[model samples]
Target: MTSTGSTIEPPTTRAMVGASVDQPDAGIARRRWMSVLKHAGLIALSVVMVYPLIWLVVSSFKPNEKIFSDLSIFTGDLTFENYLHGWTSQQLPFSVFLVNSSILVLGAIVGNLISCSLAAYAFARLRFWGRNAFFAIMLGTIMLPFHVVLVPQFVIFRELGWLETFLPLIVPKFLAADAFFIFLMVQFIRGLPKEIFEAARIDGAGQFRIYSQITLPLMVPALATTAIFTFIWTWGDFFGPLIYLRTRENFPVSIALKGFVDAQSSSDYGAMFAMSVVSLIPLFLAFLIGQRYLIKGFATTGIK
Candidate 1:
């Protein structure tokens, strides 16, 4: 009894509804597959990156003869003898080397934070006569390699009676010798909204006051980034310590670790690896503590 047009409408409406449902489900399934593949690739890369550190840790605990024989991290039997031997057999007390390294790293961090932040602020916010010219010169210095200036630096330190002392390692940081760190801070500062500084100025705040009260509070992340880099670099520096530290007593952990390399005998791979692992602990802890600051800084600063 239904009309012909009415009879055709029901089937047409059902077909359209079925097609719409199928299209979205199919699209969602494809997107979910793509996401799974992306995550799988990332997991594989992470595993690859972490494998070597695992191997190193495993090899450190392996016996000298078995270290090279077994590449599997979990298969190796663990031993603490290598660590004990490494700790006890050094000419320079390992503890003293640890202290020396800590001192140098701390001094460098403090120096870089103060000097670099000040320089960056000047470069970012000031209106001095030769500000642009000075910044250009500073940028130009970044091109010069550390090796090119090493001998000159050595001679200057020697003339100043700073050779064979921590001064050679720590003094250059006070001079804003780290052009890259300064540049990083400058870029980060530039990315901040100009209105913040303007508002502070209008409220009768001086430049120094603004820097200490406002800029510094906002710059926690950048400061942490600079501090972490300074600490790691100062801690791991071998050549500078090798050149400046003549006495075994003055040797940092980096220099003392080199003593493990025997000129005529087979090197103790197990002990060396154990010491290397031990050396990594402080730097690892440092990064863990400061990582939040670094993440927050990058997020807020909008610096690339």
Candidate 2:
């Protein structure tokens, strides 16, 4: 206490008070520096990753002879002739290939959404003999390489006379042949509240009704995830189309892209690059449209 009976803070106490006031300022400055460094690192990495794509886009606009002659992406004389030439270069217009790819992608997406969701619902909510055993086997198939079954599947399709058709690429989706999608959907269904199922049952809802109405509606995120992934995979599948599609008219965009290269003639790299840029538009649009649901699906399901 001071002489007048007013209390005074000691020097040490005043110093401690000053430190408490100043600590936030120091911390804020440190965080600001950290954020700046983090953003700079990310920007540098993005440039490194996107550089090749930028080059591809630029080269598509450049004269074919100027592609490798000029490594510079910016200094090229740009033209839309590559795109015009590429679209009509093949025996069939490029639109044919695009339409073929669209059909396959749409079929695969619908098939996967229907078949995978049903199978997932069964595995998630139903009880039957050997349920766990079957579920384990389904999960095991995810680890099995697609190549391991490639020959057998090809043989099966050949035997069924389904070769040179979209069936080989899309029908399997209707059978829930995609173990990864099945597993993804199973986890998502399992995440749903059991009480909802019970309430549905109490209201006399049949299993099919519950599945078609309750489950499907709430599983939009997972379904969107499946559809988007199926679109991307089916659209980009080169090996499947190469193996099955024999006629030029039957070829999808993936196979048609490969047609730009011919050993008997000069390659059309400019046209190829231009079509490649065109091919990516659908994928970009799909991702952008379903981005919210894709993130939610992964967040809800067990997949990262």
Candidate 3:
């Protein structure tokens, strides 16, 4: 429609403007739907992953006869006797294994934190001879399967008189034997600004001082990641404890869990499940506490 000799433009222009505005709203709506779908998939995957753990806890409360027989996690027959017997039936109380595991985990955490951080600091900050080659070798070790060196390592530990002791499990950690943690830390340390180290040195700070005061603080997320992983791995470690720990009294919670299985006659499935559930608590707590740092590092330090 025209007014006078010229066309009135507002209605057509308003229609175009409204169309343009609605375009973005449609795009946003599409994106929202996509986001919802993605989250739904993730939630489903999370439930799938957590299902076994849920089943484990639920099964712990169930009777042994009903453990495998009842496919459903929600069982009617529940008892605390499993926990009581599992805790006390062992030659020593369940507390002994818990205490043993605690000691091993504590030692490993301390060792890895001190050793891996130092190694990372050296690789990231302090430059010396053969640094690249050493770093390359350290990384190469990660590719080597643990089983390849398992026997040799065991023999070395045995020769060192570390058999039948926690040393076999704990000592290598203090020496930065786990290349994964070192690599993790090195990456995190590298992501830190070099200027901090320069400034620290400019202020007459020594290497140790710079490391302790500056890098350590800035590396909290990485360090926390290291500590959390170390605690979990050490706490759940069965191989090292199984190989070195000769007696039930010295066995960690992981090794102690085996005591419930008796092939000759009967296996205490209910009791075993109960103790396994109990064993998971410390790891859950540690992960819950340190998960923030793990997420922070993952977000900030991307393949760096």
- On lDDT, the leading prediction is 2
> How well does model 3 score by local distance difference test?
0.83
Pairs of colliding residues, candidate 2: none
- Candidate numbers, best TM-score first, in rank order: 2, 1, 3
By summed lDDT, which 10 consecutive residues of candidate 3 come out lowest? 1-10
- State model 1's lDDT: 0.83
Residue-pair clashes, model 3: 0
* TM-score, model 3 to reference: 0.83
Per-candidate TM vs. native?
0.83, 0.87, 0.83
Where does candidate 1 clash, by residue pair?
Answer: none
CA lDDT of each candidate? 0.83, 0.86, 0.83
Tens digits of per-residue lDDT for model 1, 1-304 = 5443324444555556435543556555766898999999999999999999888888888888888877788773789988887675676557888999999998899889999999999999888999989999888887776898898989999999987799988888998998777887888788889999999999999999999998888877688888887887889999999999978888899988888774216568888888888888887887798877656655654432
Q: Which scores greater on lDDT, model 1 or model 2?
A: 2
